[model samples]
Target: MRGADKLVSDSLATAKRIIDPDTPVLARFDSAFYSANVAKAVRAAGVHYSVTLPQNAAVKKAIAHIPAEAWRGINYPQAIYDDETGRWISDAQVAEIDFTAFSSKAQEEQLAGRLVVRRIPELNTTKLAAAQGQLFDTFRYHAFFTTVEQSVLDTVAADKVHRQHAVVEQVFADLKAGPLAHMPSGRFYANAAWLVIAAISHNLLRAAGSVAGGKLVNARTVSLRQKLVNIPARIAHRARKLILHLPTHWKWATAFDRLWHNTLSPPQLATP
Candidate 1:
């Protein structure tokens, strides 16, 4: 538990080093993580976080404290992004209403000017009714909580928080692709080692992408890997010098060159 806690803490702190001071961060975890100990640590660091709440008694009690009218009159929890046949929806639904009490201590470190975050799922269904034409159904929920007194808890803030969580899955993906693929020890230790190595690889890849995709506001790892690491070049000798030949027409070639020269270039290959 201690090791995992530190791992989560370190990842958040490392990401913090990369973000601009003006940008707000939204840390996330499962409901079990919504404890005072973890929250105190995060709050002491003055970072903002949003975690899932299990339908425990504490969380339910908290929901009970809020007026029923607050949830009744809102947008009824629609998705900001949808892939189905609609642009906007007003009557989204929840399968059931669960009451859970959870510690919101993670945000204690945040100042008054925090942001709103919401989560809604659009493609889920129970085992009843339309089982044959079963395409997919959507469900969504929204609740805004922030210490900020003056700011509006609107869609913009919620969107940022909601979108931030997508990165967590990427962490899992990188683990699957890299270190988590194998380890030197037993399965358990190998899995642990894989996580550590994958996390490191993920960070390096993110950094390289940022460097190579400079000034592009939304450069991501896929683009960077395609443009940089996946370079399809051949090695040859020109006069007494060695030369590497690859396509010259990539839009990011110049940036790639700069990235290679400034950082990723002239490195010895590691043994597989």
Candidate 2:
């Protein structure tokens, strides 16, 4: 937990160096990152954050204070497929409360933010055990802390935006499933170098898919690698030119050709 706080501060510092200082930055984290130091660092950085909050007494009490009318219905930007139950979840409800976090800290050090809570129906396991009729009746709650205010984004929009943090897990999964499957070197610096290379390769593949612009744009890293990068081709020379001949009737030949053309073609210069 202590390491997470410093990591967040270091990451934001690196981002600040590269990104325009005026550009708004948004930091997203899971509950493991919830801390006084983390919140303080975010506030000092002049950035916004949406961090999942653990269900503690303080958070629950804050949720209780919000009027029932404050809750608003929301549809997830994309359906979440539950692998365990083989189900799709597309809707939930969200609400927010004005609250101060790190209240245990010195009064000057406490941070103020909105506590956004999302609730969804819990599947009835009792019916499955009894082999009887089921009820989709009970609710399971999740809450998060966000520095965003109503003027910047209302409750519904804020919740929707925060839910998008799940996409980062997809990226982590991609890395783990690909170049990061094994750390080839025992040395710390060597492992770090491998990580850097892996990230660059991953981003390059994503950029290629984005340039190709189709279903491939959203395809996973492994899928992109198999479909586009790992292809059978032959090199030949004819008429003082080198030609790369790719297999005929390849499944992704068209998309590959599009990416190739886009990459090799020079940028057009605008006349003033």
Candidate 3:
């Protein structure tokens, strides 16, 4: 754990060195990276951070202390599909309280931040005879710690932004599915070079997808490669001009044409 925290802090320090001081930066991390030291390191690097907090005793206590009236209801127009529960969540209650984390640590080490909590009703179907006719409602709580000021972002907005951290995981999944499936080399440096090339290829494919527009804008790397990069074509010379011929009746013909025109076409000048 200590080694991982040190690596995170070192990486943040390196980022701080290269990034412009004036540029606003925010780091979002999951529960695995949650720690007082990690938060402190983010602060030292001059960046704002939002980290998912584990539901420990202290956090649960703080959550329980929140008043009923403080909870504000929020709705997601497009229901978020939760993988763990296998349920589509459309609504939840959000509230925040000023809380200090890592109180067990020294006063200087403790970090003070807002504990933002979101709760959804726990509709447990199984019932016990002893627990029949429960007087209070049960809810499952999700919480995170953030240093973002209330004026900049309210509880709902903060929660939404924090959830977007999962998008980076999609990129990792794509890489693992494609070029990163195997190391392919015994030497460490050779494998490292391969990794770099894979990253470059991924970025280029993403750019091609964007240029193609329509559905390809957010297409996966593999799909992009199949539809655009690895097309079957023949190069022919006729009348002192080179012509590339693609397969007829291709399903992705329109998308391919859009990509070709956007990439190779000369820019049109504005008429005077």
Give Cα-based local distance difference scores for all models.
Answer: 0.53, 0.86, 0.87
Candidate 2 least-lDDT 10 residues: 127-136
TM-score of every candidate relative to the true structure: 0.48, 0.78, 0.78
How high is the lDDT of residue 234 in model 3?
99
Among all windows of 10 consecutive residues in model 1, the one with the lowest summed lDDT is 93-102
For lDDT, the strongest prediction is: 3
lDDT tens digits, residue span 236-259, model 1: 998998888878676777887877
Superposed model 1: Cα runs more than 4 Å off: 1-28, 35-50, 55-139, 142-169, 182-184, 187-200, 214-223, 248-255, 261-272
Better of 1 and 2 by TM-score: 2
Task: Give the alpha carbon lDDT tens digit for every residue of 13-72 in model 2.
Answer: 999999888888989888988888888788778899789999999998997798879878
The TM-score obtained by model 1 is: 0.48
